[model samples]
Target chain A: MVDVKSVANPLFLREEELRQAIEMLFFAYRDFTGGPDEMLAEIGLGRAHHRVIYFVGRNPGITVSELLKILRITKQSLSRVLSHLVEEEFIIQTPGERDRRQRLLTLTQKGVELERRLTADQRERIADAFRKAGADAVQGFKLVLHGIIDAPDRERFDVSGGPTHAPVARVGNKIAGDKMPGTKIAGIKR
Target chain B: MVDVKSVANPLFLREEELRQAIEMLFFAYRDFTGGPDEMLAEIGLGRAHHRVIYFVGRNPGITVSELLKILRITKQSLSRVLSHLVEEEFIIQTPGERDRRQRLLTLTQKGVELERRLTADQRERIADAFRKAGADAVQGFKLVLHGIIDAPDRERFDVSGGPTHAPVARVGNKIAGDKMPGTKIAGIKR
Candidate 1:
């Protein structure tokens, strides 16, 4: 049994250790964003552009106000990226049916393709990491990531029609299973 | 026994779900940085500035070249922040004992106090998340984060002395063992 009393006092932990966590965050975040960033730069885009395309692709016909809420950026900040996406024909904004002042956003085919390209790279990375960590660790990673988000924003983490939303069913190994070895065939209930 | 045929096809996963993960990363990273950003803002320091102080505080005798490599930013970009830190007297640059061209960095007491404030906020958030997720989740989260870093940078990550270097035996609720209710301790082991 692990002796709880043997645990060192939390306050006694070295500042250097805590500082390392901060550096890891910086380096890891940079590397995490690096792949898509290179792709975005090629097309004269930035991370901001990727965000606009990604969100619109996820929620078709989402209004600007709703996007602002999710992004938590000023409308002015959103405008710069949104304009580029619109000009590039990656996103289409239409007048809202009820509120003409509201603009509804959707991804054009080109936008969808771009979003797919950007997201596929990210998914591959995440999936690979998930596979390496195994099922239990993947669950923990998601929980910790979810905890990092603000309470209100956490609700948006649900994928509209993904496995996360599906009912758990025990299944057998296939290609997906191969990628994530050791995961129980049963669907994760979350 | 779980039926292999019943398993969901990886190809069949909806694009929306992948997109949600992308957004989650953005929102969560923003939220994670928010705590330190607020404190830094009050002192006319941005994230870049905080990075300089953070590293200097972590490695008292680290050189400029070492810092640039650790930060992965160009020396020109680093110079701007380094100058500010030096001018403010938060960091002292001493001539290298062996190499006259190299300057060693150390944090002044004022710098240490400021650094503590910035990191304390972040540490509290990380500690809170860890408490919320528990030990297994914390380990998983770190594994995933480590995977996100570039392979080369992973070695550099080691030099930073992450959570592994934390006085794991410490028992107070302040660091990792905090059993407090509603406090989110999301462990990201560097």
Candidate 2:
């Protein structure tokens, strides 16, 4: 197991360290989403729509409620983005096998196309980052990121976390899978 | 020295790894910003406003053009959010002494209070994460985050980068410096 005793010590909880973490998140996230956001903006869809398309593409049969939870947006907010994708024929909604009232969402060929277009640049960036950080650093990177997550979402991480103990480069190559490779993301289980 | 050569090796790139990185960012950022976003929402302010308030508070003598580069948003968009903050007396703009045309932005007393209120929870969350990750993990985490930034911003990071090799806990204490103590932040220098 990772030795986390030092991490739990309060002496390290200085205010400056926390602020650095905050700025790191801000700058890193802005760049991480920048490529996708620019592309989405050009197509007249914002990040919200991108999120719907992404999750739906990842989990071909995800229900509307499940998507909402992952997004942490209300049904009303989700509806606007979902409706746009549906109207544009980028996504398809079908009734669940077990419950006709449940709407299962999936990407259309068009949705898949768009998702690829959006993710291509992001994939390259992520791959390079993994390569630069190396296996050990990558593991440490994931641990810190995972730790920052709230408990519930983290539980989902336990269920869906990618392959364990693999070299960091493998994760990147896997993420860039020929078919966007399997990010080993189980996504959210309904 | 970190053996980042492994990170650059193409053979190790896995699609799964990239996807995991994406999700980690998505989840971590959502949670990190959630508390402040809600508080901002309650006051009829959005994250855009919080950002302006934050940077201005951090760099009290920052100019408009400088702010624009940092935010990476158009002047028009910034104007809308900034006007709201200024009109409400949260921020004040003054002509630069060296360049009369340059408008320097700084937070008012009210703005400082708002910035603190908005950041309190975030500070706590970041401190906890640092404590959980320890000094070494925190360093790896920053490396990955720094790698993700675009070249220009990354260069800016070098200028504003935080401490080199100090314990993570020290960063927090240093950030709480009597006057926003300089933590070796790679902030953009104007």
Candidate 3:
């Protein structure tokens, strides 16, 4: 195995290398989302809708403010897309157990199905890549991606460990501490 | 360097691992674009505008149809953004030297400055991560990202090499081959 600590290529910081990195990200992300984009377009739902479904499916019973924080979009921007999803019966909102005023969002059965279908192609694509790249590459991929995230949000995501750790639970605890202390917003069991 | 061939962990293909990869991409892309998105918002633009500026800046004198193909957006979708950019003088469109019917897009001084400022933060972020990740990890990162791209478009990108190779040039050659044979759309000297 190549010692990650021993092989530090200063050339990687060159402008050309940096620009290459930029373009790679541009193309990779474009292709990564391509399948879901086509699928969502058929239903007249854009990326915003897909994101809402994906996050809510990931973190069942997540509150509106917590989601807004996760998405980093304004409440006004999320309102219309959210209303549409709820009206379409793809998502259902329930008041938080501790804080009745806090609406916790979860996917309906239909939402779960749509989320599964939308994510299936993506999951397979990622799996194929990881499988081909091997364990070391996967580790490198995760480290680089985690580094790309802002530090404050990095802790909220566990990019370093196994699957048993729950990132959403941490996000819930953080959000709950700030907004609804002692309340279990992200603690809703799947 | 990690002998990428030696360490093949099968567990990386598990569903949870796949999901983590998905979330990492989601969060990473979001943060990667965050700085530019804010700057674009201030100028009454969005990610679409930033993308147009970026690609046009990268491949000066790139053709309209060629750009549309790269963006995977329709004529109708690009029309408004293109018009606004042209009207605002951030970008200029001139007829191709060989094919007068084809409009070649290039950024103005203002556009170049904007693109520079917009990408500075992102470039720095990437460079920092790459420097920290070391050569092996960077190699692995590139391989995984390249693998994430679809097969058809994969050849169009040269992710395996050093700074001397130009990916946009390859894209130009490919596009020129299919449509404008023996004509150079991407050969404009910057």
Across residues A153-178, which tens digit of lDDT does each residue of candidate 3 receive? Answer: 66544444332324222222232133
Candidate 3 lDDT over residue span B46-101, tens digit each: 99999899889877888888888778899999998999999999999999787799
Q: What lDDT tens digits, residue by residue, belong to model 2 across residues B27-133?
A: 99999888999999899999999999988887887788778888989999999999999999999999988779988888999999999999888888876776787
Poorest stretch of ten by lDDT in candidate 1 chain B: B181-190
Compute the DockQ of candidate 3.
0.30
Candidate 3: residue pairs that collide: A2-B1, A2-B2
Q: RMSD to the native, candidate 2?
A: 8.7
lDDT of 2 by residue, A28-53 (tens): 88988899999998889999888888
Q: Each prediction's Cα lDDT score?
A: 0.69, 0.73, 0.75
Q: Residues A56-94, candidate 1, lDDT per residue (tens digit)? A: 776788788777876888999999999988988999999
Model 2, TM vs. native: 0.78
Give candidate 1's error at residue A83 in angstroms.
1.3
Give the lDDT of residue A123 in candidate 2.
Answer: 80
Candidate with best DockQ: 1
Q: i-RMS values of the candidates, in order?
A: 7.4, 9.8, 9.9
